[model samples]
Target: MAQVEITINSKNYRIACEDGQESRIASLAAMVDSHVKDLVEQIGQIGDTRLLVMASLLIADELVDLREIEREVSSEGGAAVPGDGEEKIVSALNAMAGRIESIADQLERA
Candidate 1:
């Protein structure tokens, strides 16, 4: 285990994590600090305990939303990202429309 020093809301914290994972820990801490800083700016120096609790809740909410999306995508056989395969559909439709136009042109010429 290695200890990483992280600063959140101007306060320093020493956290332990797997060896060589210090960067990951610091990155995650920065995200939490950003949330805490935003909370402080909006709500003003709420007690540390309250700030931590609220931040934790906010992160949890994000995780829940992400999990829900993953579940929905998995249940549909596989993830169907927004606009995935859209280009192919559009290409096929355009080709059909072009063929129809060509037929119409031929009819007019005849």
Candidate 2:
């Protein structure tokens, strides 16, 4: 496993991933960080945990929209293959959502 350092809401986290997926992880982290920053600007620095949850929900919403698009395209008999980057994005978003949910669960327990 490769450990990648990522920053979200100005806080740093070290995340482990596949050895060759470091850059991909960084890119995904950047997306999440960007969302978190945008949420902070709009809502103020409410809390790191809340900002993260909001960011995750925002990204998950995007993922849902993408899936709907893909479904429509497929239903329309379009030849566009969604397995290119969209599938990867959907998978990444799902993983992030799981992680966020786990964190939220831990926070609730605490």
Candidate 3:
């Protein structure tokens, strides 16, 4: 295991993860921090625990919406066929979904 230092709301946290996952862990922390910051800006400070809960819900909703959009696009044959942009777009979307799932898992554990 390796330790990664992540910052949220300007506070630093040292989290442990499998080796070579430092970048992923840092990305996860940045996502959470961004969400929390947005929430705070929109509604004003509401305590750490409450803000974190709200941010988690908001992030979850975003992930669900993205997944739904991806499903719709796939059903409509929007994915690119051999040697086309559609294939690249589809691949990118799949990668995003995987990343979102990883962030969600991190939020849940936090």
lDDT, candidate 3, 6-82, per-residue tens = 99888899999999999999999899999888666655666888778877876786677667757866776875454
**Candidate 2 lDDT tens digits, 6-81:** 8887788999998999999999999999988766665567788888887888788777767876676677687466
lDDT sort, best first: 2, 3, 1
TM-score computed on alpha carbons, candidate 1: 0.71
User: Which 10 residues in a row give candidate 2 its minimum summed lDDT?
Assistant: 101-110
1-110, model 1: which lDDT tens digit per residue? Answer: 89999998898999999999999999999999987886676567768887788778667755665565556557866647665345444554565445535633543454
Q: How high is each candidate's TM-score?
A: 0.71, 0.70, 0.69
Q: The CA-based lDDT of model 3 is what?
A: 0.75
For each candidate in the order shown, give its overall lDDT on alpha carbons: 0.71, 0.75, 0.75
| Model 3 TM-score (2 dp) | 0.69
Error of 1 at 31 (Å): 0.9
